[model samples]
Target chain A: MAVRTPTGSPSGRALGLGAAAALLLLVGCCTVGLSMELQGTVSLEGRLFPQASAYQGQEDYDASLVLEPELYWEGEGGLSCSLKPFLRLDTSDPERSHSDLREANLLYGADSWQLLFGLDKVFWGVTEFVHLVDIVNQTDLVESPDQEEKLGQPMLALSLEQEWGTLEAYLLPLFRERTFPGSRGRLRGPLVIDSGAAEYESGAGRTHPDLALRYSHTLGNLDLGLYQFFGTSREPLFLPSAGQEEELIPFYSQISQTGLDLQLVEGQWLWKLEALQRSGQGPGRGAVACGFEYTWVRPWQLDLDLGFIAEYVRDQRRLADDSPYDNDLMLGMRLGLNDAQGSELLLGMVQDLAQPSCFMVLEAGQRLGESLHLSLSGYLFVRTAEQDPLRFYQQDSYLLFKGSYYF
Target chain B: MKRSLMLLLLLALMPVSPLQALAETPEEQGHAIAVEADRRSSGFGDCTADTVMILRNREGQENRRQLRSRVLEQEDDGDKSLTLFDSPGDVRGTILLTFSHKRGDDDQWLFLPALKRVKRISAANKSGAFMGSEFAFEDLGSRELEKYGHRYLGSESLDGRECFVLEQIPLDSKNSGYSRIISWLDTTTYRLIREEYFDQKQRLLKTLFCREYQQYLGFLWKAHRLEMVNHQNGKETDLLFANYRFQVGLTDRDFRKNRLKNLRTGGGR
Candidate 1:
């Protein structure tokens, strides 16, 4: 199996250094009466694959360790700074051993406006199955296949709060490319992705300046958010390397996307919708993810809550899109024990509407004591279609156990 | 005969105040007492408090949780409150913002710190336990006078203080966990002394006792400690409140859903 290394962008490194210098300057000047807090977590994770790997040099089990530390300082006049760094070390895959700064920002908040500068994370959608409009941060694919984890993006953000709504503008100076699993990794595709040979449609490449605007408001039981993004697309197109037919090079394109996400709370039912229209990738197309979650509290005199979720997703780009949820139906159930341990379990399945491919997920978590937490999760791919992108992972069904200690 | 008739007419013409002339009904009297109690606790403008929650199971196993609460009083509607969890490490930085309404279901949004997402939750879970404690979500919300039908159950002596006992039925029976709540209010200060909650089956479910009463702003009476014990399950929860600040200049902006993201963990003043 080939071992691929991640490419480092020169511009991104410079921006990181510049942001760190500014952070230090701000802290040095505001340390007279600052209040500081330090908190973090360390976790050990074990992954067990039920079936033999489809590729060579893949192990049936793997172990990893994660360290995440967060520091916060609040100065006078609504000025505050936060720094969070994350690191993961894997024993099986070299590519999975990586580190990144989740947040390192200086924030100044006034009466009706605020400014944030540095690397930060922003999430923008409400549905449980997928986040169709959450595009500010790049997916940290090596960390989790669920796509819930994200790599921080460097940007300058300004927000204005008014009677009508909150409007925010972002100037994203640098883009973070999506991470991929190594060839020896269980979840990898048949053809390895040569991330080091990444290309971009823009002349400035990863240095291209991105722009985004969002307005959000809540009315009655309804919450709404509308946003527009113009810059490099977070989703990349894979092109076979010129001479290496066994490898694919990611091609980042310039695109414009407009999105709307809404949630309405009615009785025990919560309705959610996320829709987007985008151009500059292929032909202009639209995609939507709509869902509803209904909760039954203390049903049948039980001391727990049962939530039922159903969602439908569709993307006009179909197979052209990298996401497997292009035409799918998802149903899920969530159970919360509401005990002192805060035990919870979630079971879900997504079925491809156009083919005989399906995916299932199970997650359960509970607290061990005051400072330790334990969780178990499993993923299963069932009878994936030959043309489906997930076919490569048909034999990658695995269960993961994690234990975290917080300080 | 004429002189006697003149005396009767004079008696009838004498002025009589409504309070002295008419005997009050129990329902009317209970409603009036509720109105007076609500009015006495209405004008604080805003309040902030820190609380430590202790949950104990039947086997005497205990767990502790810490949280900070902020509330903005609304003149026309129910108060808006935000609760941020600080302890139990795993649940830290989680926030719940609520907009209580006088007549209908309250609107709630929960902010998950790990995801940086604010989720609009169903407000119909009033019957469920709050954070695995004996207190239900309905018990922690603002007590509006219009939400219940009150009936005066007469005066009684509790812990050497004269208290008025009232039996109240929740108006929204479909959502409320309790069918009836019997409360004992101090006659002099109209402060809540104790409450007995009856389940939907009309069985005694729990009892809550408000203790350590403290006065603020010369007129506001606040409870510094509350203990709830479930009768059927033999479980208990104690809420210890500290650092209570009133009229802290909190406004509508502070209670907005968007402000939840800015709330810091480990107790934010």
Candidate 2:
């Protein structure tokens, strides 16, 4: 199998270089008495696979190192700037060794309005299992299978705050292609993804202008957010290469999406829902993720808190959509020890409603002393259906350990 | 005998001091003391403070966290507060905004820095520990006079100061960690000096000592240091407050959930 560079997107590289230069200039021209702070973390991760890799040349174990640093500068008159850069080096998979600028933005805030420019990350969702409405940033797929890591997006945003609610408008200028694991990575599909040959429906390609508007408000115990976005869809469709049978080419389409996310807090229970309707690609479709989390504080007279989570996800597009949460039920439990170390454990399982496929996840973390944090996570895929996308990685169960030092 | 009776009637007609009026029922006396304390601290308007929290285990191992707090006093209901965490690297820039209500459950929201997400959380976890410290969420919130039922437990001398002792039972017993709290207030200033917490099983669970009292605005008394010790687990926590600023012009806008994302930690202000 042949591998391509995952972080070699020309548009992302150009924006990253520009931001780096701007960050240096901003720091150099700072006046006296301005506040500057630097903080970050360095981590080492190790993964152990229980079975042999399904793809040839893939290793049974892997090691990686990551460094993420954040720098912030604040001056007088409500002006501030922040820069955060992320870098990871993998020993087994070359494509996993990537770097990104998570945030490099300048912000100016006034009494009732604010302006922001540059690369930034924004999250907008209420459900735990799947983020149906969070599409502002591209998913950093090689970094985590859980889809929590995101690549910074280049944007200019303005926000107006009032007694009723907050309204925000965003103008996105650049699009980042989703990353894919290399052939040597364990958690990958059967065919390699040639991200370098990705195609866009818009003539402007990566420079297509995207627009988004959102309004968020809190009424008593309920929090609500409504948004509309018109842009190149972050989710891509794959097609077999013309000549290469073992490779797939990604196709990006223009899309318009309307989303709503809501959360209600009632006593010990938190009810959440995220729904979205989109038009583009082949046909119009809708998706929803709904869930509730109920907490038992100090149950059985113990010094810990236990939270029960249940979520349901449904996507009308089904197999056409690349998400595994098309029709699924997720149930989980979270335990917090409430100790000096801040120990916590979360166990969850996502069961496919249409097939005999399920995925189990376990995550546990605790702190050592003040600056060091240790965490362990395991992912297991059970009997996947023939048409299920998860079938490609049915034998790729693995456990990962990470230790981070903060400064 | 007629002259003595005339003098008694005149004495009864005159005004009585607050201390003499305490000769009424214990419940009435306790209610009056609480009302007096609330009145004395009512007009501060707003305040901001920097706090260092130190948590110790049984073996004396300690961990520290730093935070900044801003509070805006409300005239009709409970106060609104915002707490920004500055330390522990991982939790830096996290903020907790609270809108406390006197009659029902408070509204709380947590802002996660990494995700830039604001989540409305259930206030039923008021008994849960705060940041893995001995202090619970309820302990750090605004203390409304209507949240508890009180009874006078007489007077006592603590640290050579005459203090009024009162027993308070939480109005919402299901959410509170303690069955009862015995508080000691200074007689002169009506400032809280000490507290003893009893668990749901009616066993003594923790003791808190408030010290280093300082007066702000020429009238408002604030405690600069508080120490809480868990008797059952042999763990302790100390809160050291500094840089107390009163009437700092904090308004309701400052505590809004939308503003949480813009707050810079590590004393950026």
List DockQ for all candidates: 0.62, 0.62
Models, CA RMSD each: 5.4, 4.5
Candidate 2 TM-score, C-alpha based: 0.95
Please provide, for model 2 over A1-407, each residue's C-alpha lDDT reduced to its tens digit, 9 standing for 90 to 100. Answer: 54545345687567667577757756763655668888989999999998978888788999999999988888888888888888999999988888888888888888888898888888899887788899999998988888888998988999999989999999999898888887888888878877767889999998899999999998888899999999999988988888789888788889999999999989999999999999886764899899999999999788999999999999875424378878899999999999888899999999999998999999999988778899999998977888788888888999999999889
TM-score of each: 0.95, 0.95
CAPRI verdict on model 1?
medium
- Candidate 2 clashes between residue pairs 3 or more apart in a chain or in different chains: none
Error of 1 at B127 (Å): 1.2
Task: Residues B37-106, candidate 2: write the lDDT tens digits.
Answer: 8778779999899999999999998999999999899978899989998877667788999899988789
Note the Cα lDDT for every prediction shown.
Answer: 0.86, 0.86
User: Positional deviation of A317 in candidate 2, in angstroms?
Assistant: 2.7
TM-score of chain A for the candidates in order shown: 0.96, 0.97
